[model samples]
Target: MTGRVGIIGIGQSNFQPRRNDASYPDLVREAVVIAMRDAGLDFDDIQAVVYSLSPDAMVGIGNAERLGVDAVGGRNKRFLRINTGGATGISSVITAWTHVASGACDVVLTAGADKVGECGDSQTVLNKIWDPIYERSLPLGTINMLAMSAVRYAHKYGMTQEDMARVVAKNRRHASKNPHAHLRKETTIEEVMASRMVSWPVKLFDCCPQSSGGCAMVLASERYIKQRGLEAVWITGLAHSSETYYLGDRMGRGFTADHADAHALGASFRKSFRMSGIKDARKEVHVAELYAPFSNTEFHSIEAAGLADIGTSPAMLREGAFALGTNAGAVVNPSGGVLCTNAIAVTAMVRIAEAALQVWGRAGERQVKGARVGIASGNGGDHQFFGTMVVEA
Candidate 1:
C-alpha cells in the first residue's frame, strides 16, 4: 500500500444523449488522446491497459474490449477488461492502481465508455442484470428499486417531493458550469417537481438521463511521478463490496444487509482516511464527487460515507453544508454529479476523474479552494455495490 500510484492525467468526452458522430472506439480514443497528451506521453510509453465496460448484451457487441484494444493503445501491451455492472469504472481504476503500486507496471491506462442510447431501451437491458426467476417478475426496474428507497427515506425522515426537486435544481445549477456534463441547463425546483413521474416518489428529472460518452486517465507510480515531475494526485486508498443479488434475500435478513453495505463502506472510508493520514474526513477532505443517480441516494451516500448521522442529511442540506463555498462542510458533486450527468457504465469513473481534477488544481471554475484531499464513490447493481477512493494532493 505504501508504493504510491497517482493519476497524472485525466480526460473525458462531452457527455450527451447520443454520439452518432463517433463509434464506441472513437469515443474511447478521444479521451485516450487527451489523457496521453496531458501526461506528455505517447502510446508506447504505457505498459498496460485496463478497460471498463458493462455487459456486452447492452452494447450488442461481444468481447467489446478486444475491439477497443487498438484505440486504447493496448494492441501489443498487457490488456485486461473489467465488468462489475456500474461499478466497472471505479473498479477498473482500482485494478490499474494495483498494477502500478505492485510494480508490475510503471504506468497504466484506465478507461471506460458506454453507448446506452445507441443500444435502444437501456432500461430493458439493465433489467436483465437481476436474477431471472423470483426477482425479475415484479416489473421492477432501476426506477422502481430506487423509488422504494425514496419512499423508505421519505417515510423515515419526513422528506417531501419538493425536497428531492431541490436536489435536482442544485445539481443542475452545478452542471451548468460543467461543459462535459450531459444535462447542463439550470433547473428550478418547480421545474423539477413538474417533470413527469417515473415512479410514485421519483420523477423523470430526478432520474439521471441516458448518457453516451467515454473517459480515460493515466496512472503512474511514485517513481514515474518523480521522474516525470508531473503534477499528480495520489490514490491513497480504495475498496469495493457487493451485496446479495436479490432484494428479497436482503429483506428477509431484517435490513441487516443494508447495514452490511454501510459497514463495508465505512471500512473502506476508514482505511482510505488512515492511508491518507487524514484524521478528520469532513474537515480534511475539501471536495467529494459521489454517485447518486437519484436525489435521495445522495442522502444515503452521506450517511454511508460517515459524513452525517442517519436521517440527518436533509437537515445538513437545508443548512447548506454540502454546497460549494460553504465553510461548514465539503463540496459534494461540483461536476453536477450523476443527477446532471449519468453515463451509465462510466458514471463512477467520471466521479473519480472529477475528484482527481479538484485535488490536482485543474477543475477550472468548479474547483474548490485549497482542495488538498478529495473522495469519490460509485454505486452499482441496484445499489448493491459500492466503491470509495481517497485522493490527496
Candidate 2:
C-alpha cells in the first residue's frame, strides 16, 4: 500500500499473576528495551513516544505516563498519552502511526502498562464510567453488562449457554501455546458449565482474569525502514468510533444501536478495509486477533468484522473453521486471545502485537504459514467504543 507505515519491532513482558520485580515504570522500560532491540534500533532512533493506560485509579497514581516517559526514551521529545478505557492500547498505536505517517517523526514508540492486581476492586472503578443517574444504579458489573448481550444473542439466534462455553474452551486451548498467556490450561464444556457464575450466563471461566503486564511496539516510516534495510509490515488502514456514554441511549434498539452509536462495527470495519485497499477481508486477511473478554462477544465480533454472516459464528466454531490449517479458513486468536491472557490495559495492544508477529514470521511455534494480511480490533466502554486496524506484510 502507498503512504504506509510499518511496525519494525514489538515487545512485551512475560504476563504473570504479579510482576513484583518491577515497578510500573520498570515494566514499561523493560518492554521498550525489548522492542528497540527487536527493531535493531537504539533509543537515539526514536523521535517520539505515545503511552497508554486505562485509568489512574487502577495504578494509584495520576499522570502515570509522566513517570514512564524517561524509561520510554521520551525525555525532551514529543510525548503523548491516551486513555480510552479498554481501547486505550489500540488507540495508542493509532496515534503513534499518525505521528509517523504525517512525516513529523521517523520512528515512534507506543506502550501500555497496568498493575491491575494492586487495585482492590477494578470492577467497582470501571462501574464509575457508567451513567450514575440511570445505569450505575443497577450495580451492573462488566460481566453483567456482557451477560445481557449474551442473553440477547442466545434468544435471538436460538443458541444455548453451551455454545458460549465452547468459545471459552477453544480460546483456552489456543492459549496453551502462548508462553506469555495469563492462563495456559485447556478447558472443557463440562468444566465451564460447572464454574462459578458471576452473572446469569457468565461463569468464572467465561471471563478474562485481571492480569498485570505491559506491551510496546516500534513504528517506522517507509524512509526509516528502507534506510535500515529492515523488513516491515505496512499499516494499511486504521479507524475508530465512539458512541454516547450512557447505556440507556441504546436500550430497546437492536444490537446496532447498543451503547456506542449503534453497532458501528460494520461501518468501522468497512472504512479500515477501504482505506487499506483490501476487498473481501474474509478471504484476503490471513489472521484475526480480536479483543473479546467474554465468549459471546467473540461470536458477535466475528460477525461484526465481516468474517462471517450474522447469526453464523457459533456454527463456524462447531465446524472448526477458525482453527489453524482449515481450508479457506482464517486462523483466529492463535495466541489464546483475551480469554486466556487478559492484561486489561495492554489487552488490545496485545492483539495488535500478536497479529504483527504472525506477519513478521516471528511468532515461533504459534506462527501461521503464508501469513500476509492481518486484522486486529478492540472494544471498550460497554461496547460503546471501537478501534480497528489492518496490517499487511
Q: In order, what lDDT does every prediction score?
A: 0.82, 0.83
Candidate 1 global TM-score:
0.96
Deviation (Å) of 113 in candidate 1: 1.2
Using Cα atoms with residue i matched to residue i, what is each candidate's TM-score against the true structure?
A: 0.96, 0.96
Tell me each candidate's RMSD, in Å, in order. Answer: 1.7, 1.9
Per-residue C-alpha lDDT of model 1 across residues 1-393, encoded as one tens digit per residue: 446898988989899998999988998888888889888888889999999887787667897887888889887899999887777788889889989988899999988688877877677877877787777756777878878878877877787888788778878888888898999999988898889888988898999988888999999999988988887888987888766566655444455555213445566667777767778777778888988888877877777676777778788887777777788878889899999887776888898999999998889878888888889888778777778899888
For candidate 1, give the lDDT of residue 27.
Answer: 84
Error of 2 at 3 (Å): 2.8
lDDT of 2 by residue, 1-393 (tens): 226699998988778777888898988888888888888988888889999887778887888888888788888888999887788899899999999988899899998788887888888987877778777777877788888888877777765778889888888877887887888899999999999998888888999887888899999989879987997888889899776565555667553465312266567778899998878878888888988898888888887778888778888888877766667667888888888877777788898999998887777767778888889988877777788898888
Measured on C-alpha atoms, candidate 1 has an lDDT of: 0.82
Segments in model 1 whose C-alpha atoms lie over 4 Å from true places: 259-263
